[model samples]
Target: MLLIGGSVLVGVFTFIYARLVCTFICSLPPAVLARTVGVLTLFHIVLRELLLRFSPLQGERSTPARRAWLLSVVSWSLTGLLAIVIHVTRYPAFPAPSHLKFAVGYWALGGGLLAQVEYLLFERALPPTPTLSPEAQLRERLGRRLIEGYVIFTSVPVLVLMLTLQRFIYELHGDLRYLLEAVVLAAGFTGGALAVAIAYGRSLRRDSEQLLEAVRRVGGGDFQPGAVTSRPDELSLVAAGINEMAGGLQLRERIREAFGRFVSPQVATEFIEKYARHGKTAVLGGSRRNVVVLFSDLRDFTRLSESLEPEVLIEVLNGYFQEMVGAIQRHGGLVDKFIGDAVLAVFGLTEGQGDPAIAAVSASLEMRRRLEAYNARLAERGLHLNSGIGIHAGEAVAGYLGSTDRLEFTVIGHTVNVASRIEGQAREPRPPLLFSEEVARRLGDAFTVKEVDTVALKGVAGEMRLLTVEGEARSVRAA
Candidate 1:
């Protein structure tokens, strides 16, 4: 709108001045008006050419303020010269019968043009933007987007007003036309600059808000990937930062899930992230606690398998083990992997909990329940189901291991061996589950346990005191 208005004003004045030159001012002037117009045109073009060819816009060092100031000064100088040439050519008529007065007018107009450069000088005028602490500064820098709205907005209008005034003055003498052009150019440039600044500020503020939101989500551990898309150039840096943060969290999650299967969730979390480092490797071992250990073994497995096809026997064993593991996991127990048809589990090794003895007893009860359900279906086929479980409560060494070549996540100690020995003792008429006196002592106060005399375990020297928990009168406890 400003450009079109300025152009119309320039056009109207041009037509009027052309009429005056043809009929009244310089009569039959052939090259006079044309020459003046050509000179003025060459002058403004030269001003524009300075920016295009000589302006040192190299690399990231192209300071916009410096460019604007230099361009403004050159533009004002060219326009001032154009005005003076027209003034001296039409002397006596412009300054109203005085030479000194015309000189004063020319000097004032030139000074006014020079003053317009002040608008572009902003480093000394505006306040600095907000900054972050050293730790957060890297993240903030990654999210900023540099916009070009300022350059396009200011340059478009400044160029428009300058071009319009030059056109109007080309045809006319130094009069109201020159003053009107100055007003239009100054107002247009100033307004354009403010509008551009406001737009840039709004866009920057909005981008800043979004980046902050992304940072907050990362801190909160909400590591859903692909939260933000690319925005090209400077903005792409912000998206990269978000994805990088999300990736860190995703790695943590993978480690957690993998370790959780080996230990417990709480222990898994501490293992991957909280362990202290000396050089670079994690030095802190896994958290330790008194826990319930249970071991089970398939009785008559070799003979039972000898009667059936390998495929059917293997399938049956897999199905039975699957059911048993599910029962253990559902009751807050970790399956310490499978050793053929033998199953091993721990109750409180990785967790800070109640009592290991009670957990073992409760697990034994549930295991028997699951076994009966299984045997009921197989009873018709005479595929007798026989298994024994042993429970023990004691210390265990639970941590990541496996020389340096392979990493194995596990829990191992004397308690695991003791539990296996007890399981072996629960053969034939002796019952399906056996527990050590130490494990029974750790059970909840309500359990009715029968004391069984000490029996020598296979590896350990001392005979182990044992007990048998009959049923649900025992409240399960996990350490």
Candidate 2:
């Protein structure tokens, strides 16, 4: 229906153009014949549209080039057929010589104009098709659009004026004055067209540079919005799309930073990467895996908090946690969470070059060293503190846990509980760091470990052997 309506409008405009500009005497029969030919052309176009729409071979194969080629064929075919019919049937019998030249040129101009209008209508009727393959070069397509604009807006009108003046020259018996008027009109139109084209080209180049810079900034992790002013054309749509992409990236960055604050940055990064890789949210569940868990607590933290003001207590805790958490992360441990002045970290969830047991023990030793430095700083403030760390390696359930709205990635099981119980045993005569029999076994000859004692832990069925690191093995120390 759109095609039919648009065709009818084109025919009406063509009729008016011919009558006002051609000024040729025509019998009713030729007019009726031209209308009949137009009706036939419309029918042909409609038939082609219907066949293409319902063709079994029509899948997702339509392309812009194919559509443009098709529109060109249809438009020019109608133009040529109508011009041939008008010239062969009406012009040969016309009496005046000037009328023949005038009518033929006017008809050719009208036919060319008709072809342009039909091409536009056909293009609208057949919109671009979606395909999985990459499209053609956008730059090439935009360049083609600029050329089309020049032909339609500048070249077509100039041709029409030239034809009109040529007919006037023939009518006035080769008048030089009308020829001069033609030259002046051509010059003025040419200058205006050049100026318009230059302005349009400059605007297009500026917008294209802005879009490229926007993409470059986004790639460099700058997610700031771009300032690209574009006319209401393809450039405007491209600008809007780039702005939306930048906004989405900026939002994701904010989410990542917020999530990292709640959990370890390593865990947060893994969660996001998994989401992207699987193209869906991760399932809420846990898996049993062999891992090493480390637990550290400040001794007499409750008593110290009671002695200091709230602000001072918070400051001390923050300072202590910063040191301990940094030590854990340096050894590839995930800082699970903090309980009051206690820190819980896990290893082996993420694959790394070092063994999980060795990494946990190494982190514990580093925490001892960092705590001594922290103690020196506290001593300067007329205060001092101490902490105990326990490490254990065993099978535990590790994954995200909690309600859908509030989930936390952590480890939970007997392994974690045993590590916490073992930390309670670290006191005055013993080293501030201790580990279970399992951790010692995994360390093997990597570090010199001494059996501390066999102690019964709370809620455990039997007594468990604990060990403390004396020093690294000779080979490890040499390395």
CA lDDT of each prediction against the hidden true structure = 0.60, 0.72
- Please provide, for model 2 over 1-479, each residue's C-alpha lDDT reduced to its tens digit, 9 standing for 90 to 100: 65455445545554555455554533435576467547645654665566446543223444454454455445444543554555556566653432333233223433345445555664566555454232232333344456555655566567666666776776445786877888788888787877777677667766776777777788888888574766877778888888888888888778888988889988888888887435786678799999999999989887898899999989988998889989899989999999988999999988863899888888887788888899899997888888898989999999989876778888999999999999999877777888999998998878888989899999888999989988645423622
278 in model 1: Cα distance from truth in Å? 12
Candidate 2 stretches with Cα past 4 Å from truth are: 1-148, 156-184, 230-252, 270-284, 352-354, 456-463, 472-479
Task: Kindly report which residue stretches of model 1 are placed more than 4 angstroms away from their true locations once superposed.
Answer: 1-183, 205-230, 244-271, 274-289, 308-310, 377-384, 452-454, 472-479
Residue 299 of model 1, lDDT score: 95
Residue pairs with colliding backbones in model 2 are none
- Supply candidate 1's per-residue lDDT for 412: 82
Put down candidate 1 lDDT per residue, 195-288, tens digits, no spaces. Answer: 6666765565555556666777777877763445334546558867787878877786887798776655655665565552122455434546
lDDT of 1 at 9: 36
